[model samples]
Target: MNGIAVAGLSQNNQSESDIQKLLKGEILLETKPYSAWGGAVTARMYLPLERSQVWQQVTDYSRWVQYFPALSRSEVLHRGDGQSKGAKRLYQVASKAFLMFTAQVEIYLKVFESIHQKTGHQIQFSLERGSFTDFSANLNLQDFKTGTLLTYSVQATPTVLVPSLLIQEAMRLDLPSNLQKMRQVLCGYFR
Candidate 1:
């Protein structure tokens, strides 16, 4: 079980297209490094599972959406040949109330093995030509005394006009909760 506790939820409208940038958008950034272009919100959690066990949970993709909230359904777009090759899976996630839109978000995820021995597994994900332009994460799982530290380093460049800050806030709220839910489900299964 990843001992992750999450609270606070926010809502918003789905206005991703044809929207003017806020004049105050510039002021919103307190610090500016011109190199900072766009994309990504990451969440980390420690779960009570061995690295290998966590890897198994994630690889068993078919059962994920069933346990995760808003992840109403999932389909295996393609399962690669063998142990090391990548497998492609498509996901249909339900829209949240905050977004104020019932969106059918499709995700194409490819699971690959990483060279780092400490990092158990790596899964590459994308929006699959949908509302969002680019969305991906490098999930790293490390061993801990009580459990495992699961960290998701996310990178996403949304094509939609919704403020990047808003998107980041939403992700900050959603990702940790999502992981906590997963931790609970996995813990229950093991128990």
Candidate 2:
């Protein structure tokens, strides 16, 4: 066997394409490197469950802190209507540790939920008041094959003069692991 030719290919690197990007149970980092705001990330996770089931879990606002590691607290302060789909106000506190210090972000978010013609279900949130300069996120749950394609898009800017690269990295790293936790909690899958 030729070592040089053999070394040129590996299983993962060879199939790195759009078709293979969302292979079941893998997290795809869809975020661009540069953004005018702090950063934006579009993380895609393939969950082997119905879109409605996933949407039900995601719409439960107060329980978000259990799924996301960075969030220390989440509470629903108000709901626009008593129905499942509508506007609501949520208060969340997220803290990330950097080396020896921890940075905490407090935000009151205006959240909305609805059914989309294409996306199956959609949940969107924007910062009403917070420690950050700006924060907004949207979550889309779409029917994929027999399961669901969950995509989360978030843009945020910190009041502190931290680099955008750092913020993006923090988001990029946390999301995959966080979704894994959510998968286990929601789907009862363990690995």
Question: lDDT tens digits, residues 5-48, model 1?
Answer: 22111111212220111111100011111113334555555566
Judging by TM-score against the true structure, name the best candidate: 2
For model 2, what is the alpha-carbon lDDT of residue 69? Answer: 74
Estimated TM-score for each candidate: 0.69, 0.82
- What tens digits encode model 2's per-residue C-alpha lDDT throughout 2-110? 1001112222233445324455456666554545448777766667888878888888877788799789899999978867456799999988896568888899999
Worst 10 residues of 1 by lDDT: 23-32
RMSD, model 2, all Cα superposed?
Answer: 6.8
